[model samples]
Target: MGRKRKTKIFMIMIAFVLFLAGCNFNSSESSNEETGGSEGETKQVLNISTTADIPTLDSTKAHDGIAFTVLNNVNEGLYRQDENNEPIEALVTEHKENEDKTVHTFTLRDSNWSNGDPVTAQDFEYAWKRVMKDASPYNFMFVTAGIKNSEAIMNEEMDTEDLGIKAIDEKTVEVTLEAANPLFQSLMTFPTFLPQNQKFVEEQGDQYALEAENVLFNGPFTLVDWTHEQGWKYEKNEDYWDADAVKLDAINAYVVKDPAAGINLYETNKVDRIVLSSEAVDQNKDDENFDTILEPEILFLRFNHNHPVLGNKNIRQAVNMAIDKKSLTDVILKNGSTPLDGIVPKGFFKSPAGEDFRDINGDFNTGTVEEAQKVWETGLKEAGVEEVNVSINIADSEDHKKVAEYIQAQLEDNLPGFKLNIKAVPFAQRLEIEKAIDYDLSLSSWGPDYSDPMTYLDMWLEGGSANRMDYSNAKLEELVASARTETDLEKRYQMLLDTEKILLEEDAAIAPLYQDGTAVLMRSKIKNLLVHPTGASFSYKWVTIEE
Candidate 1:
């Protein structure tokens, strides 16, 4: 899921002369030929730009989108997303489920790690248990906590060895679940479900996954060079199980924080693609290479329940109702993002009856400025406070800073006796502060780890890992827990709907802002690249460079 939303901020002006002189192209491009293309031609290299440095590489600990994108390319789980974005078998050749759906058996397809060791079923069992350890801070543990005894093992009530998964033989692994879960197969597609080489990890200890050489890969690419705060390179893994299907010889990504630097790199042919800022979008709307893509991520205002002002339910409701989402999406962003009225992003999930979730919920708590001001006054009186001052935490990106500024002005001007403060910090630092509950409010976001609405709802449960704001409601938690085990399709759907109503409409736990839709500029020569709306956002397995 998203830790920080993707918004192309205003580019900083860089010296054009220095940029041109730093990157010099060889006159004889043919001499550099080797990795890809027809035999003697120059190798196919795909270069791209990312907004920030990757926080971590460990599959068991990686949670942010940037880390997940890199992990998805370097590691293969039980299943992988195909070209159509549907789950297809990757490491497992076949699988069968018991009649009650509590037990599942999978037969492994023979594969090798980049280090030349045979990938075995034990690797999967080991990795699963590793993340479920009580000391680990893995955020998505609940996604798999339905596995038999997983909750007990994670809580330390049962030993890790007592958990449900067992390696029947070198090629087979069996898993028992606490109950029937409809999303089990889809959960296998995530990076957390990936198999890890136990011996290698144990050998490296604390240093594992810190660098390219410390770990092994079984997917299309092998991470070779990772210079923190600089960039990383992914070279094709010739030993990968399906190497023949991977086209690009290498994928190089640079941590380009400034949009202008990214633009310079793209124009000089150093990078193949770069997402553009609002200014760049405006200037290049008619360019054939420019396009806008919607992401299944929503940005929201998370209020800390520990704060005196934020603890008041009416204050939270008034804040949610005041904002003009249309202005934020239309005028401020100008990047095709849709204003959100629900926690779940539009076009993300469809029910068994084939109806969209957002379409069913409609709009809630999106009221006029006048209505918000009245509610604000009433809330202040009820809380017995003359004036309230609160700080809004945000990422230290140009786009995020602008968003904070807009909201600060909106609330101060529209709500009586309200004062706003702003704090902008680097993405990594922001995460630590949010976890410490060091702010009154924060501009936060989430993208589904899988395709289920549970990905969004489960995080707000009383003691859920991602609920850093401390927001909670007993009824909402009950509904979410019941939805997990509910067998009837219609009943499950209704439970989810009820959970949403309680969180957004009744409790006003969070302020819904808008769904992210990003715009980018790319070289037309890159082909077969995919940007999926859920799970790992980008897939380059089939990508090819055209001559």
Candidate 2:
């Protein structure tokens, strides 16, 4: 549900699924083939191969980390987390917090835009005002709710800037809040907080994020071109404040999902990086370049609570009891990942008693199937339901497709007369389908924008507010809202546990499969790529490639 929790589960799975670690393999990624296709000078590019592709270049439209990875290279934030994970100044040189923590004053560096215009506080102020507008698709508005009158301001009941941020001068800006938010600084480091060119967005509207040519940047790199849903490439921005740390001359990303094809490309030197699968991992475990890194991501099954059958708690429980999460982890994904016990994975913030968010007693899995059936049978009989046929939605990734197949097979075999359908769609198509709430069920995961438990809690709301799951729980919403005011990590963590327990025991809107761990391959010839424990974020300013 959250990155910290997902990452913890992944590392733990390394021990639990050690037997399947045989898939950990490394093969030589060498290409001796000649390149004769291009007539002119070849671009000096740091090629990266990923099983997933960037879905959008526009920051507002971007939700996936894959897209954010590219954006981090292309655009920057007011502040940034260094290698130590500490928030140091990036665009703003210094920040002054008010006594009540309701206000902050920032000093912007005298940096020029890519076109040589001075980057100033007004730009940030303007961008923030736009993000607060009702048209924006981001949850950043919730963070702004504490700003004085921000709620009314967003509803168009008040004038702009009445929400609490102001540009005092060309370089100085001040932000006033409705309450104290200790996490405000850290939250600003996220992409959702990445400032934009207000003039550009206001003028372009829906077309603002549609192409590379329409965008501007103050970050390490600039997106030179974009093809929408197709892969876009990034080139170093000569105007970047820390251009010296930039490494790759350019980066090329392709929208791909076939792990075998990606691995083959890496092996042939067609691509410098790739996502390796379980079979490929097992095949090349002995290679010299073998590497493993765990990321804070997961693959979970979302139950459409609006659906007649799935909406019933009993039916949801029966579906959960029928599947085997351990086998999915121990047998199929030899790659590091743990079987989830509850909606909130372990490793999230802990309680004063050090209790985790997952419920130890009520979590249903393989062992609890017998219990699940009793509820399911009762539900089916009451709903007058005879046949249960369901379809699951997934992105067109090789792994996602395979996992869907496995799930379909497992459900059909384990539960007689239960018909299962699998619909594997492309990256963009899947995203749209999910938003429309068109599927009976789908595979989705939420990555925390910030460390707070509210990040995961917001997704369970009705009509699928975040990802459109059509899931809603009044009691869960109340728990999440109250938890946000809790500055005490331990107490907040306990609240999360209480809230998740109710969702699993009564709501059952989603059946979590496994906590996700990312498996990636890198080239030996590359040097100084900045990879953090947080996952695959690369800073070109400090990276270099060996000849």
| Best model number under TM-score | 1
**Model 2 segments more than 4 A misplaced:** 1-45, 144-161, 203-205, 227-230, 352-369, 531-540
lDDT scores in order? 0.81, 0.66
435 in model 2: Cα distance from truth in Å?
1.9
**What is candidate 1's lDDT per residue for 1-547, written digit by digit as tens?**
3433223221222443343233222111321253525675546788888877777788888777888789899999888887777789998998999999989999998899988999998998898888877334453454444788876665568877877888899999998889888778877777777889999999999999888888899899998777776678888889888899998777778777666677767776767898877667788788899999888899999999988878888899899888888898788787888899899888888888999999998887888999997888888988889788999998876667777887888888888778899998877778778878889999997888777788888888765668888888899878987888888988988898888999988888899999987888888888999876667879888998776
Candidate 1 regions exceeding 4 Å error are: 1-42, 134-145
| TM-score on alpha carbons, each prediction | 0.92, 0.85
Give the lowest summed-lDDT range of ten residues in model 2: 24-33
Model 2, backbone clash pairs (residues 3+ apart or across chains), number:
15
Best by lDDT: 1
What's the lDDT of the predicted structure labeled candidate 2? 0.66
